[model samples]
Target: MKRALALVLSGLVMACAFGQGNPARGVRRPPKLQLFHEVNLSTFWHQAIIRQLAFSPDSQYVAVKLDPVLGTTELVIVEVLTGKKISTLRSPEYLGMSQNDRVQWLDNQVVFLGSYYRWNALSGERLADAPVVGWQAIFNQDRTQLATVENVLGTPSYLHVYDTKTWSDKKIYADGLSIGTIAWTSDDHLVMSVGVTRKSMGKTIAGHQIGRGPDVGPDVALLLFDPQSQQFIKSLWFPARARKTAKGIEWDISADLMLGISCFGSNSVTLSVNKILDGRTFDIKQFYSDQQVKSNSVAMVGGQACSADGRFLFIKDVDSWDGRHKASNSIIDLALSRQVASFPGGKEEIASSENGQFLAFGGKKGISIFLLNGE
Candidate 1:
């Protein structure tokens, strides 16, 4: 009887120590964020830099591409709420020897295009030892269709379309010598970078001027097409010729609004915007002048991203031609006509939501998201 009483007393003491004062059974609440919470997203995988990131349409998951390792790149889909990894999309079998070029959301699914590889996120499949040639664009608004402008090394250029659901492909055009980037303005219409002959280097094709530089090979402009008419409607200068080198055309979206950075003269880089209506153009405004941007100096030389809603433009500073560190980049709120934020630690890549509510960047400090709450 004495031993039984002693054991019962010990059990009571332990229960009181563990369960009496704790409201959550001792689990701790996360610390509150002053500016913003440093959400720990490091547990989804091992070491590898994420090059590009995009949130799903519903904002439930974030899809990202890791820097190449073991001659292969990994695509991960992470749950936003629980911070748990939902799926990893990767394949060394298809990539073979190509590197990751770019990835974007085609509606609900993900589509990635590499040097010679094209991947479908929903089916998680790749081309079987067959490489696709040239630059491609997805309707983005519609998930099923993809437009590719191909110019085989020595052959004339051709426009092709691929239906993601059935993998059924059909060539749209085969008469052009070279094509740049194709964007679908509507289901019945497409916008493509149409180039002129090699001789039209220093002249104007339509109202758009062409550069006369020694490196000037193909002079091209953006053209709108009506699938029903099977003819070009109008052509205009591709926003910036100076900014585009081997990487092809500057960043563009098919929405009604468009923004571009162009170098007009030997020393001026201009940021211009235009709104399209009924196949007609209206110049909204030119926000930045040559004084605000400089080549090989204040401006970054790589890919830039605008918010899906087209409010903010994030550009990475290239080099210190103007005596600034040239390492850190600035985020511009075009609607406000001012630079709102700067990331100074190191060079980074940025991607913003359509509404600019959330901004994501990749840098030496790892990937980070800045939540923009209107105060």
Candidate 2:
């Protein structure tokens, strides 16, 4: 009976009709954020580091990738409401992989693209032998297709789309660009941040340096593409410093907004938002800046996530030298342009459910889930 219910829930999840409700609006008090549950990785193993987290499409479960110790990694599936471990898969070969190798959910099945291998979440089954050699991997809304970048030396980065059913892949788009974040906005259309290299360094693409140093690459611009026809659709808004390196990009499911981050040297990072419209243009706005967040010369916005309704944005401060470490994690109410709450020891990684009812955080400390109440 349990397996049967899971099968039914899986179908609903793929249809994107599992969770449907308007998220609560306005500023929510800190006290209203009740701790829904906590998953202590240390309890299962030693020196555990929660690297990546993703909520199931139906919001019934969460998949967590943890490095219990150096040179080892594991994927654990947990029931969200009960906080019970449903399944666990271990891979000793994934030693130095970071959160960039994410775990995705295709209905009830969990798919993980590791540094050198791919595996199933529940049964510990190996699906593919090749590693995803790219910056990031993203699945479509229905989980029928997967998209990744092929960044080979001395060649343009090519976008690869793989059909899950046939296991066949096709190189759709290729360009002399450094691709940052990649996502499928719809079944037919995809979004990505692409930037031109500063100069030709022989076999090496120039100006794509990530951490520290001068912003080598031209400013990254968000673009939309059609994977089926392999055609560039339109160019969206670019970041403020259109000549810096863009490190990350995220979509706010609730408000149809895009959040982008550009890192300057080793200490500074900027966050911006743009509302995606029906046409090609985007309504861009500079939402938050880390220029003033520095304390003792160590301040940076490590990670960020938005509620489904796009009312609240969660920002995590990493490497803050502030003695107190009081505002490690903060909740910003976008409508009011003010901070609502702050928490100490917040992780740099966060995730939210489609309905915006739950928020998940992962870090060296452990995993935490919070329930957002209506204001």
Candidate 3:
């Protein structure tokens, strides 16, 4: 019996030494993080309202949208290493509607939403002028196709598919459901959030209406659709209390994994990361939840993006309603299920490169980039 007990103790020590036992759990250290670059918005445009930050495919340059006070919206390209402005491209038609411009990088070209804008990287010249009316616009993996959610009033919401080469579009899905956000999973598959809003008379209290007329239901659904075949593939429903409020839902799609942030009820929010290997099976994991965040506040993931390699997820926390409050943005190592690093300040948007080497964050103050190392 003493020999057997000695053998068991020896085996337990061996497991811990090999890093294969419960003793090593929760003791793993986080990855090392370092700040690489920071670009001041005021240096490029005075009092510029920065809208979007997109890194080039090669991580050499970054595209920035600057809404100036006197002129039209400008798309500026800057060298990542030196923080020097390379070229500034302007669109006269985008003067009044600068807020709606969503810039996306497609190889050497930058395509945006307003006026169906497409611009060249080297020359800063407009390539196409096909106007598409939508809020969330996403391009496919090849940049040849574009998908957008058209939510016009008094009509059923539709998914509009466009061909970038011919500047032609078609309304593929015209269901009664209103789409909050749309993203491309691949060249053939797309994912979107669908919800419905209903109106009812509010109770009169002290000769005043107590509640708003429109009572939005909390039955939101995330669906996967095949854009090539124009067919519905699969869907996953949200919790009954998880409805989209003023700050609409946001999601990041990287290969087979999707991370979604859903804000529901008056003060409840949840972040769900789903792995959809096949169109039919969806493996979902709720990573975070906040029960105290107000409804009017922006969702925690309003400015979130995933690394292209699907190894890391970055999120900018909404610490306070006022922009002055300092918040900690986190870099999560998905495989380890732990936060690797956190940055101080309220970063409005976070983006990473295809190779996961460079990360960029944008905010009211300015934009910053970091080089991820020691993974």
Clashes of each: 2, 3, 0
TM-score of every candidate: 0.59, 0.67, 0.68
Clashing pairs in 2: 219-242, 219-243, 254-308
Residue 126, model 1, lDDT: 54
Q: Report residue 116 deviation for candidate 3 (angstroms).
A: 0.7
Worst 10 residues of 2 by lDDT: 261-270
By TM-score: ranked, best first: 3, 2, 1
lDDT of 2 by residue, 129-212 (tens): 543445466666677777777775434577888776664778754456656656555334666656544332222222233222
Better of 1 and 2 by TM-score: 2
Which regions of candidate 2 are displaced past 4 Å?
A: 1-32, 43-45, 95-97, 115-120, 128-135, 153-155, 186-188, 197-220, 236-280, 293-300, 321-327, 334-340, 343-345, 363-365
Q: Give the per-residue Cα lDDT of candidate 1 at 163.
A: 63
Query: Can you give the lDDT of residue 175 in candidate 1?
Result: 42
Error of 2 at 145 (Å): 2.6
Q: Candidate 3, residue 144: CA error in Å? A: 2.8
Candidate 1 C-alpha lDDT tens digits along 1-375:
546644654554455445435446533321111122122334445445656666666554556666545466666665433334656677564332232255566555554545334455545665352234445544334455555666754345667666656656666553443454555543345665555444455655335456676455334456665545556666655432344547675433222123222211111111322221222331233334434442322444333555544444566554555566456465555445555665543234555544434555554434555444322
Local lDDT at 290 for model 1: 39
Sequence-dependent TM-score of model 1:
0.59
How far residue 351's Cα lies from its native spot in candidate 1, in Å, is 2.3
